[model samples]
Target: MEPSVYREKWSALKNAPGNEDALSQLARQIAFSFVDRYYQDGLYRAEYIDLLCEMATSFSDTQFNNKASSALFEIIVEELCDDYEEMPVEIYSRVMSQVISYCRDVPEGVALDRRLTDFGISTFDDLYNRANLVHSRRYTYGAGRPPEKIILLSRVTIGADVAILSVMIQRFMKMFPDAEIVIIGNAKLEGIFGGNPRIQMRRLSYARGGGLFERFSSWHAALDILQTEMPPETEQNVLLVDPDSRISQLGVLPFTHSDNYLFFNSRKCDESAKHSCMAELANSWMHDVFGAGDFCHPTIWVPSGVRLRARRITESLRAAGCRRIIAVNFGFGTNPRKRLSDDFEIELLREILKDPRTVVLLDRGFGRNELLRSASLIADIGNRGFHASVACFEDSQYPRTSHGIIGIECAIGEVAALIAECDEFIGYDSACQHIAAAAQTPTLTIFAGSNNMDFIRRWSACGDTQCKIVHVNTLADPGHVDTDEVIARIMEERSGKAPGAVEPAHKIPEIKPPRRTGKQAKKAVDS
Candidate 1:
């Protein structure tokens, strides 16, 4: 539907009593239409943005009592930030100011605002001006006298943490040899990077599916942690690096003194480096800031126990005559646009099952909806006369099938370990793809959603492994996708032959391996 139609629908319901569902749906439609038009025409419509901001204000007035209401507001705000440069400056300022106002009106948001004020930011404008000033200065600490402690904030998503945060940790480790490194984020960081001795994890939970104020509450939680990490007595001796992290709401909030803080605006890319992925962009930013030498590709450190369990699973399949293992994940994490049609997944699985020597370790993705989707996919495969097994990560028994599907429910670390054991990994543009690439496994990523070519370039998996990206414009119509061509490209990737229809991103020639192996790293963690 066009923006005008959505706008009219929203107008009728904007003030009417409690058709909250319909109002929320109309708001979402309007927001998505705005994004689609922006991508298609390469222009931002100020009228549409104004309408979105007005709708967000209305939702906030209701205190975002419902999940749908809060989600609508978040969608609008995120769309504006996704291509922030294209958004008009006045509109951006208005929306951010409204966000601050909305936060002040609620208890959690009030706490968040107080925290920012404590850090010397009296308003949204104040935070942005100070952050921009820091960005322009691009200063680094003295080479001879590095800070005694360094704090790195998590990017708040597993994929970004693997691609960007891990690179920063490695680079910082080298640059400031004696600095104590602390990470502020969820427990998942421990699974991914806990093995590093120099790193410490401080938990600060962000509610991904909560209301707007609930999501903002993490900033307050982050400040509480920072108070313990960097007290006033030694504030100047500590440095905090914000990698455009969500904890700071993409640098909309300040955590430390500007002189002691460094923010890497991961979204800004020059004309010459427009196609660089986040890992590459981060390395370049570090180089420019500290004159740091060498490029660091993405890396992960799976625990030894997880690796051993993954080995047992793969060995069982190998003994059953399956020579090649393929790990696959289809979850897209709250974005339906990122996924292709069910028919596409079914056809792709059928094609992979054609090879008798290959076994597919399919991931039953997180959450109820994804679990049901995977279950249906498995049933569809069985109806077509193929054998399948469903098991958990801790299951000791393995399916002895030579060429079929083994659907497993596992944790993130287990998924990484399984991918590490596999001959190759296949998935959508999700965290598993980044994890697979970091483990040095050849990866095939089917890129869907977003017409933004720059977004695709910035997020392409980066590691010292073959990563082939097949961009399928499924946003318009999934039926238009050539399933046969995609299957052929997958086959080409497996055979180590140049893909005919798809082009692979250039691989980083070498990334120094982690300081310790899985078992050795395991010992360090235990000790």
Candidate 2:
């Protein structure tokens, strides 16, 4: 689980030194932010509460005032129980098990822990049974020919790389022809051969909608779906596929296997193990799950119809006198804080428009409203010293005929197709970038606001050598990045010029954040 506000502040407090007061204040502010969100979300999100627990623990450990932190925590928890439904008992217990250890006063901690446990909250095991018990119809597979069944448990959602997960499932079925496969995970996940005839899909009940026992029952039901779906073949291969989960404790997966491929999926991996990207981790763990498999980057399947539409769209843009078609996704939908600042974007726009033959197709997806807020935000480039044609999605010649920054959300299919048709792609860490890379489009990803550079490398368009990732952690300001540098990098990519060749007319941005003079250097979390 990731903390939204205190992530950087927490690391800073742990590091100790300059801005101690500022960091502590920020920690408190972050804590309250969680509390506000928790109340706003109607306390259904146990995850947010878990973040609060962590904040309390951090602040109570001399990082902040223990007495004040304890008071706030007590009030928050008490108010939480008063307002929320049944409350997330198991989640609280999981958190409180350590919360007590973090408390400065053992007597006070003991009293608090006992009172909390008395809520009759179901334990983790009980929750698991209640949630996933339905899916376990027959534990063992009956004797038969080579394993005839494969069950996979995952949590992939619709907005995520459903295509990659889909392809993986399809590949698995192809890899083992005899095994009948069933993928049980997120309900919203699509492209699962709903009618395409690729693989089977079943929805795992979400734990969020229910109370204590009910929640775990939902979780157990998800697991049970895996169990009951298993074919009772002589060779049955049942596997759980949550890379982030600690499945070794369940004792269901085998410790070893005769087949390397089957063995990889049946074994457990240390969650603490680090990898560059979740894909890399998934791939590695997948290798652990299924033995040696062909390495493939994530990609969405573009139907022939979509391809033809994209071509028409591109051709129309070309005929309209927009020469170089560059695609841009500002990733503001996922997290606006991470979006490229107005200054940087404006600077980049000016530089790109400077090329007479170049016309950028900005992918202002459905969430563009969240980024632009109003029409006034987008400045007229002509007045900004560059004559560039801009069009909103509503324009008759919008995405098809006119090429400019369309500040409106577009359908996923259209976005993918447009990206496929473009000459080059520019985006932040987003699905657009991923899709573009998967399509083998030349992409320049500017990642400056992530918690760590590892995430950048991990998610970097694997298998695409043409992809250029520029990691900038500008210290002076993060939200406002070095647009000039990004522009230079873009030109370099197009001209095949060596990096940093463009002479900067102004100060070059720092690759890393400004170093603080504190004793220990604390880095922020990767967002």
Candidate 3:
């Protein structure tokens, strides 16, 4: 063998047979030499590149001092280049990419693992981080393919922030009607539209798993699915709504592309307590990912228009005596641990029947208590007592009803239907809020928190004139206040008691900024 070949083989097996110390030392020396030599010439022969990659991978398998491991990893990555001759372009590119991933992650794991051992906290995040390190190792360093279509990704079903999702969807429809809107969830909340022509849905299987690794695997797998299944001619404007605080901190929001990348953050206002910290972390993340040339974006506050539409439809339907409407909720379907029992909803049946204007609409899948409670709240103050037209709205199968108080299964346009039929909205802080708002109907939104109210406020086309937000003091002390309070507020605002008090005049309606006309998309990415 030639001198270099022998040396490569020796370094590759340096950590063999319990000689970890020698192995680590040899790896460090080789790493330093490669980085130093490349810094001088700004290039590497194909043979040297291959050897360096192999050495780094071998070093990655070793358990060494965390700092030393980190330093070695950095050196290996700093020396990486795409130029090579011996291997096919494809294989060379793949190997080089994998090597760079190891350089970025393995050393970080080595350090994090050691640090965690000192403090002793065994949590899901630790496991997730470890898996992330391994996952990063699998990544091959190469340029990403240009996106076919830039999508605005929202995980509306994962949490209860329906109000924000509804407004965002409406704004997206208004701003980019030509662009395809794909929601990253399987919830049937869109069923309200009687089948929306513009929106598409994709499911990420994060909800099925039991373990931390499974969820991470699901998330990573979803990313792969997204990349692989994307069409050849898709738009290149992807935006992910990352509301989670911790993950946003890790810089997941500032996604990269072949041409351009942009980070969106809202400054700390009164909207979300978590907003300031999340923005701070996102700022750091932007710096790490994009080197910080203004990571913040202008944000606008708005109301949930979907709820307004739904409430309006509910009112119209009641006027028509459409008493068989089911409140099927495919979204938020069955979380026994978190949701109230159906039997509890059934108890409100008495209050609903008192008005003698509506009847209970029942279905097998619909939870009775939940629907009844919703019915009671909506029916409580109407001139005539009210009842649910349908028991369930969330369903894969279509219902026969021409009119009813549909729940979570429906979509934006359905609010128009509800507005045309129903008397008032009995909507929660879900996407229906925006739909109701868009329909310009009386809506009462039961809010859990004030986060994302900015976007929520814009969906209400009446500029907060048609809707009222009701929030309890605490989650534990949950109790319904009289809807009259909200009704009074709505009426008072509509009467022009104080236009400034209801919605500030300075608050602009939230909408996505148009792409720059003159610049290439990559310029946007860079900025």
In model 1, the Cα lDDT at residue 498 comes to 39
Worst 10 residues of 1 by lDDT: 517-526
Note each model's CA RMSD in angstroms: 5.3, 14.3, 18.0
- Please write out the lDDT profile of model 2 over residues 296-376, one tens digit for every residue: 444555545556666776787788787888887766433454566766766676666667756666655554464453233
Each model's lDDT: 0.73, 0.47, 0.36
**Alpha-carbon shift of residue 203 in model 3 (angstroms):** 3.0
Best by lDDT: 1
Cand. 2 Cα-lDDT: 0.47
Best to worst by lDDT, what's the order?
A: 1, 2, 3
lDDT of 3 by residue, 188-261 (tens): 44443224555565655443212112222344444544565443233244444433211222222122232232
- Sorted by TM-score (best first), the order is 1, 2, 3
Badly placed stretches (over 4 Å) of model 1 are: 1-16, 29-75, 84-94, 105-109, 134-137, 496-527
